[model samples]
Target: MKLNILSGLIAAALLVSGAARAATQLITEEEAKLPPPKGAVATDRRGILRGPKVEFVSPGDSVSSPMRLQLKFESFGGAKIDPESVKVIFLRTPNVDLTPRVKPFVQADGINMQDAELPPGDYTMRVDIKDSDGRPGTAIFTLKVAPK
Candidate 1:
């Protein structure tokens, strides 16, 4: 189904912020290390979780300057999952800093994100999404704001 234009913008933002889990939100990696996509992973291991697809869409290396962008998310390939169950989050972690900037965007059925504007900078992003049945999926992304 075709979603609203802002929906695309939100998806792009989520994509840019890969650290944000697809439908789940958390700060420390410890939480991220847990089993994901609900029933998809019966065991806990450090790797990709299977479920909804999340992608970062802007402020890429190609960017020459600071700009405001949105994160994007899409659901598919799961076993009869509901978009409403998905959760979206954006976490900013720096290289030297042990603590990451944690930001919760939104949670909804199909897609979730924020309308806030951000300046240029390098940030480690995370997106988390969980199915209604408890399945969880998360994605990691990097955003480099270049001299545009």
Candidate 2:
């Protein structure tokens, strides 16, 4: 019984370490300083299937580093959200693609990032998602991170 308990404890430790290793830098300080690309337009258009609704659930307009970032996606017209179609873009000069970094936390309902590390600054992010019907939706918001 003692050996079994030890094995379980070891397995738990490995899982925690693996999760820590999977954490990616959401945005770097240098990358955030880049100027926005010329004519970089981010627009939302209505579709026949009705786009999904994206909601920012935490870390309001202002927050600190290593914060929890949660977003909820709501679909309409009997359509479901397509997790694979999610896109996260940091609205900066030559926009930074954050989709890959946040992919692990994405789901059909939304994204729940437990540890989003960012430098102190004002940042704007554009979240784009599509429904199972192929209808697109987008949400743009600004986040201000206070200096530590």
Best by lDDT: 2
Query: What is the lDDT for 13 in model 2?
Result: 100
Question: Per-residue lDDT of 9-126 in model 2, one digit per residue for the tens?
Answer: 9999999999885646799979878886576465857444478889989888677788788999999999999999999999877789999999999999999998888989888899
Q: Flag regions of model 1 displaced more than 4 Å.
A: 1-50, 62-68, 77-116
lDDT, candidate 1, at 54? 57
Return model 1's CA RMSD, one decimal: 14.1
What TM-score fits each model? Answer: 0.40, 0.82
* lDDT of each residue in 1-148, candidate 1, tens digit only: 3577789989898887874433332233343343333232222324535555556665446443324345565555555344444433334211222112223333343322332223344445555655544556666665554433
Clashes of each: 49, 2
